[model samples]
Target: MSLQHFMDTYALKLLQAIFVHLGYVVLCVAIGSAIALVLAVLLTRIPRFSKLIMPFLSILQTIPGIVFIGILYLYTGMRPITVMIALSVYAIFPVLKNAYSGILHVDEKYKEAAKGCGMSSWQTLFYVELPLATPSIFTGIRMTVIYLVSWTVLAAMIGQGGLGEFIYRGVGTNDNRLILMGAVPAAVMAIGLGALLDKLQKKLTPRGIRLQEQSESGQSSGKGGI
Candidate 1:
């Protein structure tokens, strides 16, 4: 078939798949991030809890993507919602763990300053710590989103319907071009989104509190000279 014929036949379905994939990924990321942030905050307050959560998250990470998808499909009887839930579960760990680590690792001096200012625990967390942990949280979000999008193709196996439909159809028909058409676009989207998110993080990251410390030191030296 001509390229035009292929476009005429499959372009709309391809667009639909793109939207479906994007929707699933965004939903998973938003839900996972919220849970991760809350967990991270709780873990920071109780380091022992981090130990408990981290091991479980690590085990979740070990489960293969295909296995997770299949298990959900078997239990949920081949629904798209099952695929979404499975992907969300699989995407949770990195964000949760990283957010916990990031908030906990904020410099002691900043925490001290917040306390000295009589900031309550909640106020210190919202005002002093979260902003400092933005880069790490962004990292976790980026990773989770990328993984969610890439693994969504497996959703097709359960009749959940996405770009993977094309892959499966092409395989059934032994059509190399159709297979490439679906696979290539999905890969491009995953990498493209990952890069865009990384760029966003870099632009948004603060110039570290270390910059403030350096400026203070320089000002003190000039005052001494004066």
Candidate 2:
């Protein structure tokens, strides 16, 4: 199809598909991040359990996206909630792992300092550990958002509606243009959202941590130049 013809034919539909695709991505990330954050915090308090639980979650993460969604659809029927549940579950692993790792790896001296100041466990977590962990947690969130954009395409398999509709339809009919209509937008959306998150990560991370990272990076580069 010619460029003008493709645009004229699909302009409105493409907008709608992008909107639907974006909606699923946002909802999955928000829901997954919240759940993961809570579980990560809890896991920190029970480090032993994480040894078992994290491995189990890692196993689940290895499951193919299509298989996961298919199983959920079979059990839940063809509903939007099915897509949400499947996507959110898939989204949880990265954030959960990163958040747990970040919080766990926080410097012991910081915790000691918080205790010296008479801060309680919860206060220390909120003011010290979580702040220090923000960059790592944000990295997981960025990963989740980008992955979710691509995963949301699977939602169309069960009629949940997204760019996948174009791609899947194109596949059925062997139409490359239709495939591009879905693919190019999804790629752009992923890049755009990832960039936005990069900015947000810098802002959310503690200034001291940022400066420390910059110093370390410079030192590494300087040594490499020797």
Candidate 3:
């Protein structure tokens, strides 16, 4: 088919698919981040269980996305909720691991200062630990967003609309153009979203940390020059 002809036929469908794909990405990331953050905080309070729970979550992450979605579909009957649940579960691991690690790694001095200021446990967590952990948490969020861009395509497997519809259809008919139509957009979406998250990470990071990093980088460059 001619390029113009293809566009005329599929442009509206493509737009719809992009919106559907974006909706899934946003909802899954939001739900997954909330769940992960809460769990990470709770685990911080009870460190002993983390050894067991973290490994279990890592195992869940090992499950292939297609297989997980397929299993959920079997049990949940091909519903949109099935896809959402699978995607959300998949989204949990990276954020959970990073957030847990980030909070744990916060310098003892900082925590001591917070305590010296008469901050409560909740206050220390909110006003100090989480802010310092923002960069790491945002890294997990970016990973989740990029993965969801591609993973949301699985929604098409059950007839919920997304760019994956074009990809799967193209594969069935051996049409490379159709596959590209789906794939190129998803790649672009991932890149664009990842960049946006990078910018957000910078904004959310503490100014002191950013300045320290910049200073360290400059000193390293000067040493190399010498």
Candidate 4:
């Protein structure tokens, strides 16, 4: 069913829901990425912590998103903050794994080079390691944002008012158009946001890497011509 009829009736409400849904996603991603990045950096500095923390986080991630959100709703009474907390926890794992893997997998030679240049531990991390690891880190962020957008629908389950409101209402009423109203915009948002982030990933990637990739592509073309 086309969303036009439903949209015509509730255009303002739907627009508000979209913005609210987006706000939840933004909050969750911002908080999740900050915490994940910090934990990733800490784990890298003390490798043994990864042994314990990684397993714990993996276990937490294993719990279904709805289950965790439901549990939080029971305790917190349908508050938006509870929904945000649940979303943040769900959003954290991708970036955490990416940051840990990205930093840890950085070439040892680069570390040695940084040290040889008299860079301090902190300086080496920020200047040399993070720049090289940026592409991977951005990959994590891209995934997290997309995940959060999908997950934000759950906010409606708690009466916090998001696109999920229409979705759940539509489900209860057996209205296909209402369901599409919620689902279609969400899918579009996720795809559009993912594309934007992909562009950002390229831009944020180190210039050296970008140039090398371009040079390699040129070389490959030259070889093909030969």
Candidate 5:
């Protein structure tokens, strides 16, 4: 279809679907990150439980996306909320794993330094550990957004409309343009969001870590040059 015809036919509906898709992704990621971050923090506080829990979460991550969505829809019926719940659970794993790994790997000496400075356990966590973990945390968040953007299309399977609706219709009607209309925008959204998050991760990452890494690399090269 020509630009004019495509616009005349689908401009408004496409815009609406895009907005719906964005909303779904945003909401799911927010909820998932919050839940995962808390769980990660808890696991860090109680190391024994982490051994037991992390595997469960890893298993959850392995469940097929379509299977989870189908199961949720079966119970909740064809509602956007069902999609939201399913997607949010799927988004939780990366953030949780990163958060757990980042916090757990904080140097014991730095943690002791925090304690020596009169910081309590939680204070040490918030001020020192989390700051050090910012890069990892943000990386997880970026992954969540990208995953959600691609997966939101699945929402249309149960009648919760998004770009998936167009893609589904296009497939059924054998219209390639409609499929592209849905797929191309989704790809753009994923790429755009991923780029934005990359920038965000850089900004949130501690400047000291970057500088230290750069200095370490320089010293390594200087030694090797001899």
Candidate 6:
């Protein structure tokens, strides 16, 4: 197909690819972050468990994506859900590890202060630790999103349609234009989205901790203390 014709014909497919990949990445990050946060919290409460689990998570990260996906496909056998499971699994380690590290690094004095100020354990976490850890956790999540968008191309192997179809089509037919058409757009989308999310992280991240700290501080000053 002519470039213009391809653009016209495949515009929707491209959009679907963009959205599907976007959803895929976002889901992986969300699921990973949720699970990781839970695991990290559990580990924090049980230091001995952190030593056991962190190493296992680190080992999972060491396994190459191809090998991991291959193993999943062998056991789960090439399905859309399997593809998602694989990607989600691969994406979890970074967020989990970072969350654990971030939570651990929260200043002891701050925790003590939060307790001194009458914060409960959960309140201390929500009001202090988690807010401070947002940047680190989000950094790992951002990395996972970028990684998954590119990795989702592998989904085509299982008949999970996306931009990968175009590249596979090109490869099978030896059509250079088709390959370029697919590869270029996918790259542009990943890089562009990653940069945008990075900017968002910077903007949305709290200056120190507690997203509304500046406003809260202002309100406290205005009220002139208890």
Instruction: Name the candidate that leads on lDDT.
Output: 2
lDDT of 3 at 11: 96
Candidate 4 C-alpha error for residue 200, in Å: 1.9
- Model 6, poorest ten-residue lDDT window? 205-214
Screening candidate 6 with a backbone cut-off below 3 angstroms (N, C-alpha, C), the clashing residue pairs are none
User: What's the C-alpha lDDT at position 49 in model 4?
Assistant: 90
- Runs in model 3 deviating more than 4 A are 221-226
Higher-ranked by lDDT: 4 or 6: 4
Q: Report every candidate's CA lDDT.
A: 0.84, 0.94, 0.92, 0.90, 0.91, 0.80
In candidate 4, which residue pairs clash? Answer: none
- Poorest 10 consecutive residues by lDDT, candidate 5: 197-206
Residue ranges of candidate 6 with Cα displaced over 4 Å: 208-226
Could you tell me the lDDT of residue 129 within candidate 5?
A: 95
Candidate 5 structure quality by residue, lDDT tens digits, 1-226: 7879888999999999999999999899999999999999999999999999999989988988889999888899888789999999988999999888989898899999999999998999999999888878888889899989988999998889989999999999999989999999999999998998898777778899878768989999999999
Determine which window of 10 residues in candidate 4 has minimal summed lDDT: 1-10
Residue-wise C-alpha lDDT for candidate 4, range 61-118, written one tens digit per residue: 9998889999998888878889989999988899999989999999999999999999
Task: Supply the TM-score for candidate 5.
Answer: 0.93
What TM-score, to 2 decimals, does candidate 3 have? 0.94
TM-score of 1: 0.86
The alpha-carbon lDDT assigned to residue 166 of candidate 4 equals: 88
The pairs that clash in candidate 3 are: none
The digit string of per-residue lDDT tens for model 1 on 1-226 reads 9989988988898999878877878887888788888888988988897788789888888989888887777788778788878887877787987787789888999999999999998899999898888878888999888888778888788887777878888999999887887788888888988999988887777776446647989999999999
lDDT-wise, the better of 2 and 4 is: 2
